[model samples]
Target: MSRALALVFTASFGAMWSFYLLLSVVPRYATSHGAGGIGAGGMTGALMGATVAAELAVPRLVGRFGYRSVLAVGLVLLGLPALALRAATSLPAIAGICVIRGMGLAVLFVAGSALVPAIAPPARRAAALGVYGLVVGVPAVIALPLGLWLAERVGYAIVFVLAGGAALGGLAALPGVPTRTRAHAGAEAGRGVVAALRSPALAWPSAVFSLSAMAAGAVVTFLPLAVARGSGGLAASALFAQAASTAGARWWAGHHGDRHGSAGLLLPAVLLAAVGLSALTLVGRPIAVVLGMLVLGAGFGVAQNASLALMFEHAPPRDYDAVSAVWNIAYDTGLALGGAGFGVLAARTGYPAAFGVAGALVAAALVPAWRDRAWLRPVPDAPHCPRGYR
Candidate 1:
């Protein structure tokens, strides 16, 4: 990996670390403070809602200010706001912090993904992205669980201080990232996200990725509630397994995509996810739940990498920011919608049947994935792009 790319990874790591640290902590904190179930839902809903909105707008800002500037500003917004959370106990105050942090997350995802293709060589671009995914995923694997533990052992105030500081510390890495973007023939990147969505090549992958993302949302959001009453620990373990699998598989998928093509992986990804969902039918069985999660995570990993790499392959470098925004919109919105939808489905049909239906939805993505099968074929034996496409 290049120095610049590595630096971006570092910044992303810190940003994600801070974000994960509060993922579970925030909702519980809100509930304890009198935000009832609906209020807590609003708390997360508001954060993700703002995050999706900002994800769309961030690409435009990247085109104007460059990646480092946008990213630095994001880190500041994400970090500085948390410092204030130490004193704010009301829902409105908490919501405000979530909104600011949500915007920061939007900036980090858009700017960072945009910067990746610009810095990494075309030949290994997918692999580089996988590594990047690993770097960022580490936080979710660690801080997510650690955050709650720290809060319980020490206190929420200390957790708040550390979380904010971790995010703020990422700013130091910003000065090292490049100010310019990868050059392209047209101004497509500046053409707005809606226009990008108009491309069938781009939209298809986004759709497929969204299906899998929805499942990811369901697993994390409802798996705990779906299991036995005292299975909170089991749910956490399963979630961790899924997250770890996704991370490892992402890198492997990128590496495999470089050697073969990403399109071929699409059908398999959906199928794997379906199998994983099928295993969830046996959710009452702890081992079955873990196994299903692992399989599903692997599928999700492949889908994530393939969709991203294929989108990048088709689009000119100029469109990277827009591409990033579009893919992330799929990610955040899918997660939000999946969690919301699955909740309703579970209430009506029960967890086991709901999971089966969720799998069916993911399987349905295969039709669109099939259409892109031929598109992802890499040039034989002679893999890797010759050089940077300036």
Candidate 2:
């Protein structure tokens, strides 16, 4: 990573760390305040709902305020509000905090992502993105479980301050990144998400990415419950493996993607994640569970890097903000939808059957992945650039 990109990655890590630290903690916090399991789940739902809403609007916000300004405001919103949680322990107040913080999450990701295409070295952009994914994905591996562990021993208030501070601390890194908005000749005209969706090249990658994320949602949400008894601690180990594998595979995907078109990686990744999710139906086998998540994570990582790289490649330099917003929207929304829907299906069909169904759903995404293979072929012409560049 370049020094500038490293700073952005650090900021990304800090922001995501705060987000994941509270990911599981908030649910239990709600239950302590007399909320049932359903209420705990509702808190997460509310947070995601707010996050998606904010992500859609952030492109416009960045256009006006610049990345540094909007990102600073987002960091403050994400970090500062947690300090107030001690004063207002009511469920309503808690939910309100989540809403405000959710907007901050939206801004951080969109701004951070837009920065990637601009600052990354052109030839090794995929590898740079792999580095980006690794740093950012660390929170999911560490903070998620650690937050709950710390909350039990010390107290939620301490955890809240630390989490908030992690985000706020990132302000030091912000000054290093360029805040200048883009000035591509046609950038303004093609500025919105709607315009991005109208382009098949941009839209299809997001569509396929959402499908891979659906299984990721189910795995992270249900794996522990699915293997409660016999799997030894391998289930948790598997999760760690999954996170680590995803981080590593992202780098590898980028390396190979640069050599052999990124779009070619999509179908193979779908196949891998599908197999892993299918194996998850064998809930009793420790090895299967471990290997399953490992493979699934690898595929998910590949999908993450490939789809994002493809989006940046096909879209003009001008549309990076819309591209970032759309990608982040797809990322969070898919993960949320996957978890929510899988829970319902699992209730009716049981974990094994539900997991199998999830696998089938991912496999079905292969159809779209296959169609998008055209992305591997050389472009007939580059619309955004001149003839010499094409």
| Model 2 TM-score, 2 decimals | 0.87
Every model: Cα RMSD to truth: 3.4, 3.3
Error of 2 at 341 (Å): 1.7
Over the stretch 227-281, how does candidate 2's per-residue lDDT look in tens digits? Answer: 7655425545776778777878887877776677677787688688889899888
Worst 10 residues of 1 by lDDT: 381-390
What is the lDDT of every predicted structure here? 0.79, 0.77
Clashing residue pairs in candidate 1 are none
Give per-residue CA lDDT, model 1, range 1-390, as digits (tens). Answer: 778988899899999988878776776677678975445545556666778999988877876777788899999988988788878899999988988898998999888887887788887888888888888777877776676667667979888888899899999898899878656335543557999999877888887788887788777656755789766677767877887888888889888877776777866786897789778989999999999999998998888888888788777677788888998888777776666677667777888999999888878767766756554554333333422221
- Segments in model 1 whose C-alpha atoms lie over 4 Å from true places: 33-42, 85-93, 151-155, 184-190, 349-353, 368-390
- Candidate 2 lDDT for residue 360: 91
